[model samples]
Target: MRVMVLVKATEDSEKGFFRDPATIEMMEAMGRFNDELRDAGILLTGDGLKPSSEGKRIAFDGAGRTVIDGPFAATRELVAGFWLWDVKDVDEAVAWVKRCPNPMPGPSEIEIRPLYEAGDLQ
Candidate 1:
């Protein structure tokens, strides 16, 4: 099975909390965790994202499409980063997430969802 792990953005993340001096420890911890995932052959890809101000949104309605600039509202709903992993099942993904270090300085959340495999449609 494959899964996408979503790292939800927090207010601090939107403000580039990773740039803060105090976050060095957190970064190191995350690096170690990432290494663990890679060593276990579960991690396919992962990376953190820049703030929403640097992004754009494409909204579609009927045959029309509108391009909206970012610095979007709803901080908690935005994704700060993601990981694509090949695992045995959602339970395995959950177990890995449970072992992860907090991605935010104050509060944070990581969501795990299974990817639709080709066999799923059959």
Candidate 2:
């Protein structure tokens, strides 16, 4: 099975806070986690994204179009990073995620979802 692990951004992330010592430590821990996944042959691909300010949002209303600049409050619901992994099952994926260290100080959330396989659509 394939899974996507989504890293969610916090308010400070959207605001582009400088990396403090604690934040640096957290990032190092995340790197180590990725290393572990790679060593285990589970990691397919992963990357951290830049702040929302560098992105754009588009909305379509019928034929008309609208665009919004980033640094959007909706960033709270947007993904800051993602990891693609191959695992045996949901339980295996959960166990791997449980072993990951927290990526940031305060309340950061990571969501794990299964990827749709060719067999799944049937």
For candidate 1, the TM-score is: 0.95
lDDT against the true structure, each candidate: 0.93, 0.86
- Please list all clashing residue pairs in model 1, or write none if there are none: none
Q: Report the lDDT tens digits of candidate 2 across residue range 5-33.
A: 99898876666647788878888898999
The TM-score between candidate 2 and the true structure equals: 0.88
The prediction achieving the highest lDDT against the true structure is: 1
Cα shift from native, residue 6, model 1 (Å): 0.5
TM-score of each: 0.95, 0.88
Predicted candidate 1 versus true structure: per-residue lDDT over 1-122, tens digit per residue = 99999999998888875456778988889999999999999999999999999899999999999999999999999999999999999999999999999989888999998899999999
Error of 2 at 16 (Å): 2.7
Q: What residue runs in model 1 are displaced by over 4 Å at the alpha carbon?
A: none
What local lDDT does model 1 show for residue 68? 97
